[model samples]
Target: MKSALIILALSFIATFSNAQKKVLPVTNVTTGKEIYAKHCMTCHQVDGVGAQNMIPPLIKTDYVLGDKKRLIKIILNGLKGDLDVNGDMYSGEMPSQALLKDDEIAAALTYVRKSFGNSASAVTIKDVRRVRAANKTISK
Candidate 1:
């Protein structure tokens, strides 16, 4: 009976520990730089200067360094219409990148915010998850 009790306790402890372990999503793409290169470099350009009067620049722009939630949504849902960036009117449409996993989105955005002469906070995985959940954005 004592042997059985010890086994049961050990089993419970093992189960609890496994449950507590955090599992981050797996992807072939690692690092924010890689994600940015694959997903964002074409539009924003290698230096993030973007096309003149066309795609908006990511250089110290309010949109990039602004509210984290809005930025996350932009990546998830895409954006249309014109934006007045640093007193310049830029017009373009950004297609939805919702297919990116939460970690991917967070990584790319964090990279953008930190790159292109912009110094903003890193977008956390928790932040992405919360925003994704709030907006019902699903990742493919």
Candidate 2:
């Protein structure tokens, strides 16, 4: 009976382990570009040059290549108030993209980071999840 119980436990563990494992989608530059074109390109522009005296450019900006957590939060929670980018000031209201799925946000951010003449690591779904969870706690 003990041996049977042990076998059952092992099977449960194996099943749980397999259930916990997830295969994330491969990061596609084309998908990212498409997402950007659909959602971001309007403001940031295809060149990511942004509008002068209004939208801040994403090119090589510290905000883009800086702390991953803050960047993710900005995407999830949106941004307001004064922002200085490369000696210019922008006070535009960046609405929350929290409605976007985690993968979509990651892809868009990854595209932004890797493109616009900026070379940075891709933003993963894990990164987005962590920030979203933390933001929830902070808001509550």
Superposed Cα RMSD, model 2: 6.0
Residue-level lDDT for 123 in candidate 1? 90
Worst 10 residues of 2 by lDDT: 19-28
The model with the greatest lDDT is 2
Question: What C-alpha lDDT values do all the predictions have?
Answer: 0.85, 0.89
- Pairs clashing in candidate 2? none
For candidate 1, lDDT tens digit of each residue in 30-120?
4788999999999989889988989888998888999999999999899989889888997789999989989888888888888778888
RMSD of every candidate to native, in Å, equals 5.4, 6.0
Model 2 TM-score, all chains together: 0.81
Alpha carbon lDDT of residue 131, candidate 1? 95
Please report the candidate that would top TM-score against the real structure.
2
All candidates' TM-scores?
0.77, 0.81
For candidate 1, list the clashing residue pairs, or say none. none
